[model samples]
Target: MRSVLVTGASGGIGAAVAHRFAAAGDRVAVHFVSNRAGAESTLRALPAEGHALVSGDLGDPEGARQIVDAAAAELGTIDVLVCNAGVAPSEENRHVIGDVSYEEWTSTFRRMVDVNLLGSANLAWAVASRLIERGAPGAIVNIGSRGAFRGEPEHPAYAASKAGLHALGQSLAVALAPHGITVTSVAPGFVATPRQEPKLDGPAGDALRAQSPFGRVGTAEEVAAAVFWLASPEAAWCSGSILDANGASHLRS
Candidate 1:
């Protein structure tokens, strides 16, 4: 079984991804930032054995190193790295270009980019470096967003950060190929996680859902499934690809 490290293991998507690997008999390192309780709950929900928890703030560059190091130290080597931890600014602070304040824009962009972009890059580097040094083949799956390709009027920062992550995945795919490391991205549209339900309720939510050709939002488990496939040996030839889990919502007319 492969050894996998999933960042943001405290949340819906991250936890689901961890469970998927664990259920498949792969050793899983569950990484959490502030949700220790939630991470523990996820561990309890999983099948017994072969899974452990590691906590760190991905917003800090060093945090990514610490997480990967700890997990590697325990699991010997990481076969898969899932950079799934991320954050969006508060609704109250959501901004458009013209209306965005300096502080709000900088802080919002920094928070998202730090964790979503930098953190992912840090983990990718750490995992890829180790894999290269040990001459092992591995995979890195980055959780991107459909918003990366589409326009998000009030969430420019979030969208931009995800866009950057997508680009990073492609670049890493090429850069790490010689090392036998593959990097790919999974971009999910409106997923119905607990953190998203608040915005996905009511008329506004219904309207947004209607925009999708499938006329529905996605589930965290569905995205997790995609991650599983990307990390699996079956996808060895799928490096640098951005798999869309958005139900054709952003398809061109």
Candidate 2:
């Protein structure tokens, strides 16, 4: 079985991805920042054994490296790296240009960029370096967002950071391909995760669902499925691609 490391696996898309890999008989390293209980829940729900729990603050560059190193040590070697850890947009970090103070705007941008883009970049470097040294083929799947393309008016930092993440994956795909390692990313839109349930259950629910022709928001499992496939050997040729899991909610020209 392949050894996989899925960051932010405490819940939502990360947890789903962890389940998908484990269900395929692969060993998984479930990484969490502060939600050990949720991470344990995800670990216990896995179908197979050998799954482990790892924790670190992705905002710190060193923490990102530690997380990858710990996961690799636990799992023997990381065959797949799923960069799913990131700071999502919320009321606390909202920084609309005209509405928020200059301090809030700059701080929000820094935090989001640190975790969403730089953290993922550092993890990729750590994982890919090991794979190269061992002469092993591997895959890296980044969890991006449709907001990168569709625009997050109030959460511009999130959108910009994800956009950078997608670009980073593409660059790494080219750089790592010669080493037999593939990299790709997934951009999802309006997923109805537990954290987003309130939004989906509120008055804006209909508007969110109507973004896609399916008349429903995406699911964590669906996003996980895309990530799973993109990390498989069969999809190696699809490296550098940014798969849209938005159900045609926002088409890019």
Candidate 3:
């Protein structure tokens, strides 16, 4: 079985991704930052044994390295690295241009970019390095967002970071292909995770649903499925591509 490392596997899409891999008989290292209980729960819910739980702050470069190293050590070797941890757009970190102070804008941007972009970059580097050293073929799938293509006015940092992540995946796809590694990214839009329940049940619910012609938001499992396929051997030729799981909510020309 291939060893998989899924960051932010405490819940939502990350948890679903872990479950997906485990269901396929792959050993998974479920990684979390602040949600130990949730991470444990995810580990317990896995269909198979040999899964492990790891924790670290993705915002810290050294912490990112430790996370990958821990996962690699636990799972024997990390053949698949899913960079799913990210700082989502929330009220506490909201910084609209005109409404927020310069400090808020800069701090918010730094925090988002550090965790969302640089964190993934660090993990990719760590995982790819090991695979190269061992001469093993591997896959790295990054969980990006449709906001990268559409826009996130209230959370411009989030958009920029995801855009950078998509670019990073493409660059790595080219750079790592010679080493028998594949890199790809998935851009999901408006997934209905527990954290987003309030937004879905609030007044903005209808508007959010209407964003897609299907008249509904996405599910964590759906996103996970896309991630799963992208990391599979059948999709090796799809490296450097960004698959959109937005249900037509947003399209790119």
Per-model lDDT: 0.88, 0.96, 0.96
Assess candidate 2 and give its TM-score to the true structure.
0.99
Per-residue lDDT of 20 in model 2: 97
lDDT of 3 by residue, 1-253 (tens): 8999999999999999999999999999999999999999999999979999999999999999999899988989999999999999998888898999999899999999999999999999999999999999999999999999999999999999999999999999999999999999999999999999999999999999999999999999999999999999999999999999999999999
RMSD of 2: 0.6
Least accurate 10 contiguous residues by lDDT in model 2:
89-98
Across 63-154, the per-residue lDDT of candidate 1 in tens digits comes to 88999999998787899999999886457759777787788788888888898899899989889989998899999999999888886779
Q: What global local distance difference test value does model 1 have?
A: 0.88
1-253: candidate 2 lDDT, tens digit per residue: 9999999999999999999999999999999999999999999999969989999999999999999899988999999999999999999898998899998889999999999999999999999999999999999999999999989998999999999999999999999999999999999998989999999999999999999999999999999999999999999999999999998999998
| Sort order, lDDT high to low | 3, 2, 1
Clashing residue pairs, candidate 1? none
Q: Clashes in model 2: which pairs? A: none
Q: Global lDDT for candidate 2?
A: 0.96
* Candidate 3 runs further than 4 Å off: none
